[model samples]
Target: MLLVTGITGHSGRYFLQELIKNKYEGPIRCTVRETSNTFLLDNSGLKIEKVFGDLNDQDFIDRVMDGVEVVIHIYNIHHSPNIVQTAIEKKVKRVILVHTTGIYSQFKYASKGYKLIEERISQFKNDTKCPTSITILRPSMIYGDLCDSNMSKFIKMVDKLRIMPVISRGNSLIQPVNARDLGKAFFTVLMSPEKTVGNAYDLTGEMPIKLIDVFKLISKELNKKTFFISVPLSLGVLMARVLKILTLGKINYIEKVQRMAENRNYSHDNATYDFNYEPMSFEKGIIIEVQEYLKKKEGSKSK
Candidate 1:
């Protein structure tokens, strides 16, 4: 039996697609909040047991862990400790987690909590008392769908505004792995646990791209000539603060500006070698995402 969480989330939705694509014959179970939109899961054409409960609930976790051999947790990384503990207690054979590359961020506020969560997971893995083998896959900025607030928001902003404001002259490098690519990677790891277990893989995109180039690519896809105004990092942060104040905290992007100034490029050579993980190029992936976004926009208008 396989227990998969976050089946209704951004990456999870695509991961479910991979499972369907591969024609996985295992008994699958998923835990979701009562209000979580299960449209995709319902239409996935795969038999999945949907458990209604929070992962934070110990009783619920124990109930769902019954007869579960392997667990694929695609939910928030913050809940890893509890999940890992329960898996260990339940004597689950293997556990796969979707962590983030934010642990590598220079910003203390952003990386600190991830580091701590990872540390606890490490402790569990090192413990001789534990029987579960854990593999952690850390992915960079994930985009490719409307559920992605990062690139989807960027795409919408670029479409709505003629001039795009960038921080650090839009020179900072970012490697955004498509959600579909990430989902495929998860399936790849699931099939090849010998190569993935007890190790962590960085799942970045095909290449690192400048933020400026990203804006230009979207503009090209939209067939709109866009202009760029590079704002100093310090000034961008100040403006975000001002806007947050003016909006009565409805809009806050201070951390967003700070994060934009930092380079978020990572190597996936290990993932490629281990599980034949090949991600799509941003140029190609962004085109699909833009098309999907525009289609959805047109869809909403007709309703």
Candidate 2:
């Protein structure tokens, strides 16, 4: 049986779609919270065993880990150390973990926890007694869906405002992987364990594009022209700090603006060579995202 986590999440839903499309014959099970909506899973028509409990609970983890040969872990990376430790303890044959590229960030504060989690995974990999094979996938900013946090906000901002404020002239290059591409990459890695196991791959977009160009692409797809207002890095950081304070620490973008000043481009050559991973270009992906955003926008108006 194959065990999956985060099966109801944004990218996880896409991965589930791939499993359904391919008609995966293996017995599958997923861990979901009691409050997690099962709309997709209920309607997916897949006979998946649903186990409800908190992953943080040791008893719950043990219950879900029962009789599982392969595990697809798409939940929060912060929970990985515990999950991997349990997987190792249970002697699961193979485990695929979905991590993020944020661990490579220059900012220590932002990447510290991710780095620590990966360090433990690396140690587990070196342990000779551990029988599980671990493969880690780090994806860049994930977009391509209305539920995504990155590009969807940009599309909405550009659609609503003619004048868009850009940080650092929006010059830094970013390669955002589409959620579908990332999800498919998970499926690809799962099927080819020999090539993917014990290997860490960076899955990114077809090419990196300037941040301003991303905005321009969204504007083009929306059939609108936007005026860019460049905010200096220093001033942007200051404003983020002020906003955080004003929001009583509810809204924080200090690190976000700081990271925006640096380039976030990485090579996916390794993933491509390993699993034939091919991601769509940002332009093409943005066109679809913009259309989805418009449809959702119209949907709200109709309601």
Q: Highest lDDT: which candidate?
A: 1
Q: Which residue pairs does candidate 2 place in steric collision?
A: none
Superposition error at 33 for model 1 (Å): 1.7
Clashes of each: 0, 0
Off by over 4 Å in 1: 43-45, 243-252, 301-303
User: lDDT, candidate 2, residue 303?
Assistant: 100
- Model 2 poorest 10 in a row by lDDT: 38-47
Q: Alpha carbon lDDT of residue 46, candidate 2?
A: 75
Per-residue C-alpha lDDT of model 2 across residues 1-303, encoded as one tens digit per residue: 899999999889889888888878888899999899888787777778888888889888888898889998999998888888888888899888999999999998789999999999999999998899999989899998888999998888999999988888999999999999987998889888888988999989999999999999999999997999999999999999999999999999889889987899999999999889999989889989999988988899999
Best by TM-score: 2
lDDT of 2: 0.90
How well is each residue in 75-177 modelled by candidate 1, as lDDT tens digits? 9999899999999999999999999999999888789999999999999999987899999999999998777978888888889999888898899999999
List candidate 2 stretches off by more than 4 Å.
245-250
Candidate 1 least-lDDT 10 residues: 39-48
The local distance difference test score of each candidate is 0.92, 0.90
